[model samples]
Target: MTQVQTLDRTGTDAVAKAWTHVRGNLRRSAGQRLFDQWLKPVVLVDGSTESAVRLGLPSSFMTQWVKNHYSERLLLEFRAVLPEVVSVTLETLSDEPQRVLKAEVEAPAMVPPPASAERPSFDPRFSFQRFVVDSTNRVAFNAAKAMAMPGVPQFSPLYLHAGTGQGKTHLMHAIGQTFLAANPGATAIYVTGERFMFEFVQALRSRDTHAFKTRLRSVDLLMIDDLQFIGGKDATQEEFFHTVNEFMSAGKRLVIAADRAPQALEGFEPRLAGRLGSGLVADIRPAELELRRAIVARKLEDMPAVDMPAEVVDLLAARITANVRELEGALNRLVAYANLSNETITVDFAVNTLGEVLRSAQRRITIDEIQRAVSSHFELKQLDLISERRAVAIARPRQIAMYLAKRLTTRSLPEIGRKFGGRDHSTVIHAVRRIEDLRAKDVEIDGAVRALMRTLEG
Candidate 1:
């Protein structure tokens, strides 16, 4: 009878209270990074019965992640809190069934009518002011700014390429915002390759492609992102080639971004690749340790309450070498967990709190990877680096390879030297020193080294 009275209490209230307690327990036990990333967003759905519990997540991917990792744990936690709870079910907060995550799919694209006065809003957080710039992305940053200027840009088709989360999209958004501000009456349109193909197909189906072409070409500044996705779409490529011609011929500004250089795009026509590369092709290199630290500091400025220590900052920057997004994510996770647990931010706290994340971010780059990247960059055979050639053409690339090996790998100098033709530790040291000095004084060498590092690290 007492248990019946307990069950008589509104199921919503009882379940909500139990959910809150279970979440707190999970947070404390699962560690901050994993809890916040996967379980924090979970909500108790309204379909719970006396024996079964339903939990809702925003998407299928998250549902799957949590279900795979914490289903049994969740069931145990709920049953511990409420003896009547017999089962836990995780589901997406949607009517649709779970779908497999796949590559970017083409869909009907929406371009604002040329006659429409309304403008698309740019993400306020991604403005140029928020961008952290250094040697790695300075050229692309400057070129993006130049494209946004009032008059015709110095470069007609500014092509920007970088690995994911490397600020290519940030630069594109900044360009759109700046261009609109500089020319109040001008029109700017941003679309991804998938969207471009989608809109084109929609136009084809509706037999209204003239409007599509007009809407796209009539814009004053047109920016395309994820251009790699459009490869092998011939009909879409034909229209795109014309769009590029229209902009170039009309002197309108065009900016494009992809994950790789134009020359490396697979299944792309040579002419389209050439057209995209005809203008200034700038690459956003991977963030160096200094730049990464600066980014962490800049991010912290936004969270004034989170007083992260300097060593923790250094450890994060050094360990999370993957990309800017992960680096910032690590910092945010650390700050959030510390706040939740009321723990002071320290190097040890960061390490323990972000153990899983720190390990995953530490991608071990090998000397073989570095050598391959350098050899490809210098157009030398892979063995040429480890061979006995002393020609400046081969020797300089070999030195660069040795320098990269020492800097990028955990291997000792002797191990690195051994990889590079069994040279002595002194030889490896000299190469490292020479490259370091050249990186300071010689722009070309510095640029080459930066490119190589970006390739390897990215």
Candidate 2:
């Protein structure tokens, strides 16, 4: 018996034919177990592009599993039947309800949007005109603005580090937007360090690394937020270091933002740290009173109809000194509460709405909590982590625990010593110095210390 062949089609028709062929082949050639476990959840989301087939998986595990066991086989079969397809791209569907809601709300507005026209580039709301540049953040803002100019390499990496809500992300985004506006066709990517690590790992595992390098290298500007998250991932760090080198060699701009300076980042490789520090480093300080007031005014512009008493604004500016996010959150609450209750906004209302968040931010975490968090992360018993057991494994973790406890907590050396199996105050000091020295000399040690600090702080 002879089988009939189907005629080759063009464009969307061709994509549909190719997808059907690939799916039918997988169902027949692969066992029921593999099909159900790995291939069942995969859906053909986009087939408009002739050269690529976009598939959506349910989760990261499924994506990894399919890529590991069946990616090559599936590609081979698909190519044999339809040679036009070049690659398969897998993405996981986001599960968050809020994301779904946000997408639904925004989808209608985005339909038929102009392709070449970008969204009002700089978040017109977040300009230097509105940014509260205090003494602490003034230098960093100026440096960032200078770096954003055309034909300037004032700072190659341009590392911006500070605690949460200290405007690192804001500055980095502003810089990217500024550059793109000034130099048309100057592309930039602003990604969190976690996303960078995720893409690096996925590319490495799938062996489509050339594509990865091209995606990162082809951009004229790269801005990474929360650089600390990638500190301990060796493979990601290696890939990122190469990307940094390529960008720097080409005189392309690189901007990195983290919660702490490169010298203070624990688990980051020394070589990576050295490269980061080679350029200008700016530390954004905590928001001052005037800066806080400016932030409030900027936020109020969003709700122009809502009236806030001047005294209430002053009280909030004076009281909420932690970060910009917190300050704005407080203002949001105050506005919401006042609007709902139909009451005049006052100092008393502001106090009531913002009391808990402010107090919590001011609440100091104790040394014991830091010790416990560090111990739990390393899988050592809390007692073992705090004990002076001089075993290489236990000692290193113990010393790191001590160092974090001292730095993150407000406890004195002697007080921290008492908590750590009653060691002498000098012993506590010694442990801190030892960890610091090791961190400075050894990249591996630095990575561990950084990992421990993140756990403790969290």
Candidate 3:
């Protein structure tokens, strides 16, 4: 019997050594379904650290699938068998495969790239010019534009808050693109809070946290979407706080977006909430009928041939009053239906196609539901949250609940006041003012109110 060497020597010695034994194990395990589908596609591009291995995947779908289903298992196996890989990252392979792989191999040795320097993959269709300004989000849109002007510090971290499908993400990207255009060399990064957390965890596991910090802190502008998801993670929050401080101290811009206000982010640390609230916070209210109609018209500009009746558009604008995402979805469905049926888009056809979504949007939220959410968030009895107690804690929370009820529901001041221990309507007015003042002046108070609002809205 002749013995044969299985591994090939390569110019990148580190990568070769790291994969010498792992490739054999993987080959043996290839029969497994998951190993074939998720793991087999990932090729080790380089080993920058003794504990971190870079992997290249063919597509984003495969990268996400592997990350979602098998990242931990892959990491564990690599760590146990290779003894060199502390973590494994699945990066999408670029069209220029060799160039991307070379960059990955050399990245660890070079100074970490600036966070803002990483150009975001923004959708050109979503720009300030294209976004229809209406009563619902005009203030937010104007504020974002003002903040985007070169050398302006009107709001360091403009927090855009609203329910999902509202154009918060669109606004953030628009600001980034606008800022870059104004300041040619200006750097900006657009990442979801979830991506921030994911990158932070990856850094921690690989013991390359210093590089991560350097990259993030070097950014001139950092925009985080869906920041409410940053709740419940102590380590990530700590890292984020320092990053925020560094950027703010250096007069760099930070923009964050969330489905609800800062106070509504349960499980988030108080200090993190305070930092987030320390700048201008604007809420993008749900779209009104006119705004929805404008959005439909603007979207239809791209598909002029797919015409719909005025009544159909009016019905959609009036009936499907959800967020912009739903609005776009309805239009997409109508266009597709028309193309398939070879029929002109009509009011009846639009109604039948989008009946379910329209009906769902019309679902009503009650004052009672708001009261219960408020009570739970404040850790008080349902009656306590609504009672006219003058104690600082109870009174403030009660006022916030009343404010939410007034703003979110169609309840009259007198009706809301009656629900809250039959207090006078004037009391409701006072509570609303108090909360509004606090929101404008006190960061902590603003965060708390926002958090409570999210609970109620949910």
By lDDT, rank the candidates, best first: 1, 3, 2
- Candidate 2: pairs in clash: 266-446, 266-450, 267-446, 267-447, 267-450
Superposition error at 336 for model 2 (Å): 1.6
Q: Write the per-residue lDDT of candidate 3 for residues 232-346, one digit (tens) a residue.
A: 9899889988888887788888998988888778888888888888988889988765578888999888886866776677667755766889889988988898899887788
Q: RMSDs, each prediction?
A: 13.9, 18.6, 16.3
Q: Could you give me the TM-score of model 2 versus the true structure?
A: 0.55
The TM-scores, one per candidate, come to 0.60, 0.55, 0.59
**Candidate 1 has which clashing residue pairs, if any?**
none
| Candidate number of the best TM-score | 1
How does residue 152 of candidate 3 score in lDDT? 57
- Candidate numbers, best TM-score first, in rank order: 1, 3, 2
The lDDT for every candidate, in the order shown, is: 0.80, 0.71, 0.72
Q: Tell me, by lDDT, which candidate is best.
A: 1
What TM-score does prediction 3 earn? Answer: 0.59
